[model samples]
Target: MAVSSLSLSLVPRTFKDKLNEPRWSESPRASELPLHHAIACSCDRTTGFDEEISGNCKRRPLLLGVVGSLTASLLPASSLLAQEMPANYRAFVDLSDGYSYYYPSDWREFDFRGHDSAFKDRYLQLQNVRVRFIPTDKKDIHDMGPMDEVVSNLVKNIYATPNQIANIFDTQERTVDGRDYYTFEYELRSPNFASCSFATIAVANGRFYTLTVAANERRWRRVRNKLKVVADSFKVLDI
Candidate 1:
């Protein structure tokens, strides 16, 4: 299956011109305006403009409404993204190491030799997430090699067992917070068992970080979207 990408913008706008408008000498009484309009114009007092305009203050609500509408429209997509995030998951931030991500909250941390951090599902033995880093002399993921070659070598040399056959399904390159990341999806089938994984590779703070999320092939289809969320959440925090 093809991997999908997600994007979000969270910046809010400041209506400086409307906010800086001069106050009128003679202010209209609150009773003179409609209830909603009166409430909207009340912002002037809080904004340090003590006086109100004599003419229809309808423009205040319009200006405020424009700003409010803009904010309302921009917020839901991002908010829904957050709200719909798996409730069983929680954020993990390695401040000292300068990396952060979200993982299944119920999963327990474990020592997976050579990895900086690792987590495994409580119920599914094959479901796991791991992050490891290596000091990189190069500055970026591309410097190691082309994305395909790098991912191929990683699967064949590191993940594929001698008796197992690995098939690459999809690969994607993305940038987050100005850092580039290469993500790959693949399946490894052995004589007895099969597992699928999504791995993301990136370079930051002079180290190459690899985050892998895996599950039994039988369960992969059911949980691929959840695992993808974990895979995509891996990020190098700003130092």
Candidate 2:
């Protein structure tokens, strides 16, 4: 499996540094494959985290499709990712890989070896979202097989380590722009830690894209809905 890369234009850590920075800066990571950058808003215009994410995701085209695609069944009127998103979630767009997803404005980029792009909580690293893609000959996610069986095999055999316990809670399939996508919920528990997560996968532009958003088991309930928005928002764009 040959994986591709992802990138996002991250904001500087300090308020003073933000004031002097450009609106759309390049990703700081180095990669052999081409990487894309997010279209960011001017940092000085925001007063708090809420406004930052709202402004960033709303103004960027990368997220317009995401917000537009949330069906009524997926999001009730009161859902945060409904017609109007909360001010704390921003979009991370990879123009090159042709995929995008939302994440908390407070999270910072980190190197999660094997993943093209990732972001984690400043204090709790386990609460994070990451995306990676690999070349594939298959034309659609359905090419893998039935949703339940395929998801189970991937989680139990590929995603989880031999020593970890993997339990899949649910699996779903959706179609957007004539493309098929499979999203699932699962738990991976090891001797040291346990985490619950939602994963979305799709095959497009000759690549298999996977985006996972997770949180520690203890924090799952509190952050599940927010992370669900991230997982559902994963979009594979036309490259």
Candidate 3:
């Protein structure tokens, strides 16, 4: 918790910095986990294909604050985990749209989302939420309504305020081995994207799936120690 030299001059010296860490000029894969160099662990808010995950797990700052306090238990009416994420962090190549799951890698499969999707179909391509900002809006974000209600209506409509933006915390159901799914977690601190916000989750493909980790408020208190090794390295596989 010692980064503030004005956020270390807002980080980035050579990786052409502007906040999109992890990515060492390519050429490092076997299903990923070593291209760090700076931005620790990001898959936005991952965890889905857990074969007891690997990447040698061993990052302990109180286990990254118990995985960012279990991402407010996936948003059970908001508790918000303003930072704490890193457990030797791991996850790569997990994509399934069956009932909830994601963990990009395959070099992010040409990362595409859409509002227009051209000019190399959007840049900020670090893959796995840090820079998948993707705002051309209007259709084919998977045609909306179902990635946990487009991440709970974008945090209950652009970062909460109507009674702390609640409702839809998988009362819509979410499960594993027994199947059934649909999950969501959320938190915010506005300036509407400049004041920095984080703690988001969505799990769908059955009912739903969404997770976020925006950053600010001092890197969300130094990256909330690593949001429970990125939320228990989530899983929903079938692919």
What TM-score do all the candidates reach, one by one? 0.63, 0.66, 0.24
Candidate 3, lDDT over the whole model: 0.29
lDDT of each model, Cα atoms only? 0.60, 0.62, 0.29
The prediction achieving the highest lDDT against the true structure is 2
Ranking by TM-score: 2, 1, 3
Which candidate do you rate higher for lDDT, 1 or 2? 2
Give lDDT: candidate 1, residue 3. 10
Winner on lDDT between 2 and 3 is 2
Error of 2 at 184 (Å): 0.7
Those runs of model 1 whose alpha carbons end farther than 4 Å from true positions after fitting are: 1-86
Kindly list the per-residue Cα lDDT of model 3 for residues 1-239, writing each as its tens digit. Answer: 11011111111123233123222211222222232222222122222211101232121111112234333332221111112212233232212121111222232322222100001102332112322112122222243445655556555654455444333433234444554333343444444442233333332332223333233344445544443233333433333
For residues 63-151, what per-residue lDDT tens digits would candidate 1 score against the true structure? 13214444443233223235334556765544435566678767865544445456788777569887766555567777777888888
Model 2, 1-45: lDDT tens per residue? 221112212222343432332221112121111122233333332
Once superposed on the true structure, which residue ranges of model 3 sit more than 4 Å away at CA? Answer: 1-152, 156-159, 163-187, 190-205, 212-216, 219-221, 224-234
- In model 3, what lDDT does residue 23 have? 23
Q: How close is candidate 2 to the true structure, as a TM-score?
A: 0.66
